[model samples]
Target: MILDAISSAAGTSSAAKDRAGIADNFDTFLQILTTQLKNQNPLEPLDTNEFTAQLVQFSQVEQQIKQNENLEAITQLAAATAATNAVSFVGKRVSVSTTQSELTNGTANWQYSAAKDADAAKFTIRDSAGKVVWTGERDISKGDNNFTWDGRDAGGLKLTDGNYTLSVSAKDADGETVTVGIAAEAIIDGVDFSGEEPLLLAGDTTIPMSSVKRIHNQ
Candidate 1:
């Protein structure tokens, strides 16, 4: 994806090669025109106007190829800048809009916001296998609410430490669905450059740079 993004920004994969081929062909054309002029009868010289126009056409093509090269350079520089900026995020904590969370040290935390006052909010915790291991209700307010789970299942039995997901469903007093947004916080362990954009490695979860809502100090 990263390569695709870069290539898309620069134009095409064969852009440089195409430009080189165009330059070589133009040089050969110029040589052929020069030879034809030298061999033409001086009594009726080859039409200079036609050759002049051909030269202009070749110049235009060369200019366009140069412009494309400049654009490709700019695109490469921008990608490098993004990667450099992403390096600073390492070791810092960030809040990302994601459903997955890591259960470390026997706990996991998340923050959710309610659009309106919800009479009731149900929280469901699912393992990586998509099995609902825990389900409970949380007393939520109209705005922001924080939730914490102690790595325990519905039966109060401790679960193994790993990655899990939290989902919240809320309803207003009218029983209509209440819009909710969920977010998870984690420390940026590293940056993954294997994608179109840098991915923040937060424990076992990979969060895209665009998904980060906020960054916090460690």
Candidate 2:
């Protein structure tokens, strides 16, 4: 019976449940063994070697279960600490590697770095519904460059304040593509822990912790 319990203990969802079941079965097994030894006749003595071995196995299993529980406790504590640290990112300005940035009031800013100078560098701005609102050419040399939008469309029409996506394509004089690194800066307003990784919320954009590059104090 104790062997069967051991087999089933692996299927238990939590360490606490496994410990409870094993403890109950171990106690019952000990009581049965003690009573049988007491009632055995001296003329035909019962060997206790098998019972002793089983007792040792049960002890090992119980010790392993206790260790698992302790490890689980440590894991939970570490998760709590990570969550607390993520929460502290709120209200702090951060720069993250992403294509999307929020347009507020009248301006939206983005940063990009170029590996080599391009003869022709063109960029397009799109709104939430994948509609291109503006398109313009930029002078992206072999260094860092900042692009700012005035919340206006291609025809000088003002657009609503919301999230915008910027896409850039560049080619050198020889028609070879230039590598560009794009990033955006925003103040983290909230955090979403529902996903596998903690996400920092910044005005309709969900930025993963791994994507963040720098933190600035407000």
Candidate 3:
């Protein structure tokens, strides 16, 4: 009877709370069983099989509760480790796997790796609203290449400081399309842990820690 009562309570409580309830009920169950056995009629004895089954069920419930506690501990440990790692990125410049970068003051910078030398490589700049802002020839090398913008549109007009997207197109001497992978760099200012995963804050932008490709000196 007490086991049935505790089982119903276990359904609605958390592992820690349910575990305590189960323990209390289990103690009461043992006492009741002992008293029943002692006062039981000898002609019609209490069924040992039913008592054994109840004991086994209580054992299983306790084991499951312990396992739930362990899993919670592991999850909390993992979240703490991630927050620790994210905090270390503060003030560090990291290359993120994105085509977007912020233009601060009068300059913005990006980097890309070229698959091969492009005879007609060009860089295209787009504003936050996806409007074409600037386009020009890109002097790309075989390996690493860095591109910097002066926050100027194609007509030499200064543009406002904000986020912009960079797109690069390249072609070899034979006019075949070449691969150009764009990477945006930003100095992490802080960490936002409100989300499920930590996000690195760079000024007004929020970048996921998982998108970080390289960590440079502060």
Model 3 RMSD in angstroms:
2.7
lDDT of each: 0.82, 0.85, 0.89
User: Which 10-residue window of candidate 3 scores lowest in summed lDDT?
Assistant: 9-18
Please give the distance, in angstroms, between residue 87's alpha carbon in candidate 1 and its true position after superposition.
Answer: 0.9
TM-score of 1: 0.85
Ranking by TM-score: 1, 3, 2
* lDDT assessment of candidate 2: 0.85
lDDT of 2 by residue, 17-115 (tens): 657777777777778778878998989887778777888898998898889889989988887887887899999998889888899998989988889
TM-score of each: 0.85, 0.81, 0.84
lDDT, candidate 1, 1-218, per-residue tens: 22223334555435566666656556666676778778989898887777677677767867888898899899999999889878888998888898888898899999888899887689999999999999998657888878899999999999999999999888988899998999989898898998887877877678778888998877
Candidate 3: pairs in clash: none
- Flag regions of model 3 displaced more than 4 Å: 9-11, 16-18, 117-122, 137-142, 170-177
Q: Which parts of model 2 are misplaced by more than 4 Å? A: 5-18, 39-49, 193-197
Q: Which pairs clash inside model 2?
A: none
